[model samples]
Target: MQFYVGWSHSDALFSDYYSDCPTLVSAVSDNQGTLKRFKNKPNKLIIDCGSVFYVKQQKRPTLKHVFEIQRSLIDECPNTSSIRLVHFDEPMFNKTSLSDQYYAMERTLYNAYEYLKVVSEEKLPVNVSTMGVIQGFDRASVHYSANELKKMGYRFFGIGSLLAKNQKQQIEFIKYAIEAVGAENLHVFGVTGITQMAEMVRMRVASFDSTRPTMAAAYYQVFYSNPFRTYVISASRAKPQSDRLGEPLYCECPVCKENPQDMFIPSPRPYMRLRSIHNYYHLVKTIEKMKVGTEREEVV
Candidate 1:
């Protein structure tokens, strides 16, 4: 299973672990500015250069621009294997023209798939995954778009925008689309709760990204201050991983069990210090537990 950790803006915004850790990293980009910034990072990282669609809803640019961006990254970092092209679709109500929105979406999706299929045939390795995303606020529309893309030779699928709120619905939709499209790999955008992880894993969805462990580490330091209030705030961000009454327990991770309350500090700001030395120990340990099966004796 390929674990895709998505960085919302730039890969630079994430901690050093993203650049150094072997876990796969996916980054979003709409323009060349961020592409120039991140296409050079070393590590066993695989980038998912997001959305080829423009926001203005005008005449789409010639397909040459999409190829150029892909070509630029390939030239700079030949090791980058997977390229997940996202498609940001506008809501039906907001669109300037309603003339065949479905047809237009299908055309763009086909064009993007055809562009990558051509590249794969010539220069890229046959195994290099060119994943496509379905962008829509509604689950049904997203599923429909994903199915259409699959018909155009896309095997992997991505879901965006709708995930931040209706994660459960996203999971259900992806499950149906996976069966419909015969998708081997599915990625859910912008969510990584413990419960959500269990569900995704069961559904055999390839990967999902989240800053939950990092956020949990930050919550640990503040929990002791006003345990109830801190738990309330942190719970809103991500569900608790363990049962420890608001202490932000990390029982599944060995480092947390060993270090306990010293895992993080709150002197400065909570978010900035989330990746501090102590927090990293637990964070890495948590990741290891998630990746490698932890023995009872080790975690206990």
Candidate 2:
């Protein structure tokens, strides 16, 4: 199991050793050049393009361009462990009563597979995992989408949008998908923070992703609250802040740990940066704790 962390649509930030946890980077637009930069880092990167809705809207590069990134990664980083492809957005099908919007997204996802097969045919040495996006605003929609994708040759599935909604409903959606696809082949998206860790782990997700660790401290200071509650607006900002905040306290992480309640500073935006760093540490530490607990349970 791995946590897809330290992600930015543009730059690299999880450079500190303490912040060095297994993370996944975006793989949009055949970003071989970019992937190569972090090639030797302690992380497994995934190429995450927006969802089918985004594809249809042309928010990212064309399907062909995304494949080109695969080709580039293959050509550049020959020794990397594996690469993941993500359809990174919510299912619009559940968003509206209109069937057209739903089908349009579905068709876009289908087209993605065709493109994936073509990329796979090129045959890179690394393992290629495809993420299945579950749709609908409710349990029924999630169930339907999961079953539909399982039928379509997806080995790994991802459940997004549903996570932030009803917890029971989200778990129900994940439980059903795992049952249909098998627990060993499922990955849950956006399962971050102290709130969802236990529940998500119980769901038996092979891996989960979040930006909490990178943003916790920033959130705490910005909101002047507890580490367990405040929300960090963006993950990109969290990565760097985690580094800066994790510095000094001999954090071992490039960004060491610091007092969560330090006064806000305008220069270098210490306040915001500290919060992000604090969030990253919290995230990394929490995951570590979860792993230790799981290991102990197996022993007992």
Candidate 3:
């Protein structure tokens, strides 16, 4: 699966190394020129409403909100390679009623259908691949959601509201959904992290986006990984690592190559940037390995 960068980060963190990977630009997280700037690169654009219900702590938007974004995307950024129609997600922590969850799912299908119908009728150039966001609380719900989206002519589905699930639950949802919707048509939104995803290399996914690696910067940590394992460099000397061995940290990553000594110092923001780059590199390579079924290391 190709990993897309989330919109909440500074674009400078996105190096030319990732120019081929599509980046996600959310209406909620990005300002003007972000999408256009990405458009100038080799990267494909993945546009979403950025309606991360739990992260933003908001209710599902009205059809008007969905329709407006659909129109705006078609009119303004019609060149996007992929467009995810707005969908309602009932966050697991919020404990929304089952009825409410089902209601949102129904509305999501309606929104997706209407959005596609308009795009087609308008003769918009967004005739690219479209993804329907799917949310559910159980196996049956997941299956139903997938089937409903398929009926709405959405062969690509983004499994949402899963960032909070444990690895097992996440795998369960993914496995069942893959069985229900077919693996070729699935894209996971905001996957948990590299390790969890690595465990899932047994399954194939079309694409996914993640921002958790960037959070390591805030927690005063650095991450290094190969496909099979991830290493955390705490820089606290609680454990013996190269920084304490009087050895230079060897890496070609922009941060490590240009700012070798910076890894020894513990600054949250810079470390976050460096580590986010480090983790993202591993993730991209990991997915690449999965694609070819050649495993020198495991990265998901």
Best by lDDT: 3
Off by over 4 Å in 2: 9-12, 15-20, 28-32, 52-60, 73-78, 87-90, 98-101, 137-141, 215-254, 257-278, 292-300
Query: Model 1: what TM-score?
Result: 0.56
Lowest summed lDDT window (length 10), candidate 1: 221-230
Worst 10 residues of 3 by lDDT: 240-249
Residue 26 displacement in candidate 2 (angstroms): 2.9
Per-candidate TM-scores read 0.56, 0.70, 0.76
By lDDT, rank the candidates, best first.
Answer: 3, 2, 1
lDDT of all the models against the reference?
Answer: 0.47, 0.53, 0.60
The model with the greater TM-score, 1 or 3, is 3
Sort all candidates by TM-score, best to worst.
3, 2, 1
Q: After superposition, how far is residue 281 of candidate 2 from its true place, in Å?
A: 2.4
lDDT of each residue in 1-300, candidate 1, tens digit only: 344444433222332434443223322235344433553353333444333234343664444554565455444444553444443333232333445556555555665566666655556543245666664434466677777776777676765544334556666666665665554567665565544554555566676666554454455422221111123232234355544343455443333445544333333343334323333344344444544434222322
Predicted structure with the largest TM-score when compared to the true one = 3
lDDT of 3 by residue, 172-194 (tens): 88887787788778877777555
Candidate 2 whole-model C-alpha lDDT, 0 to 1: 0.53
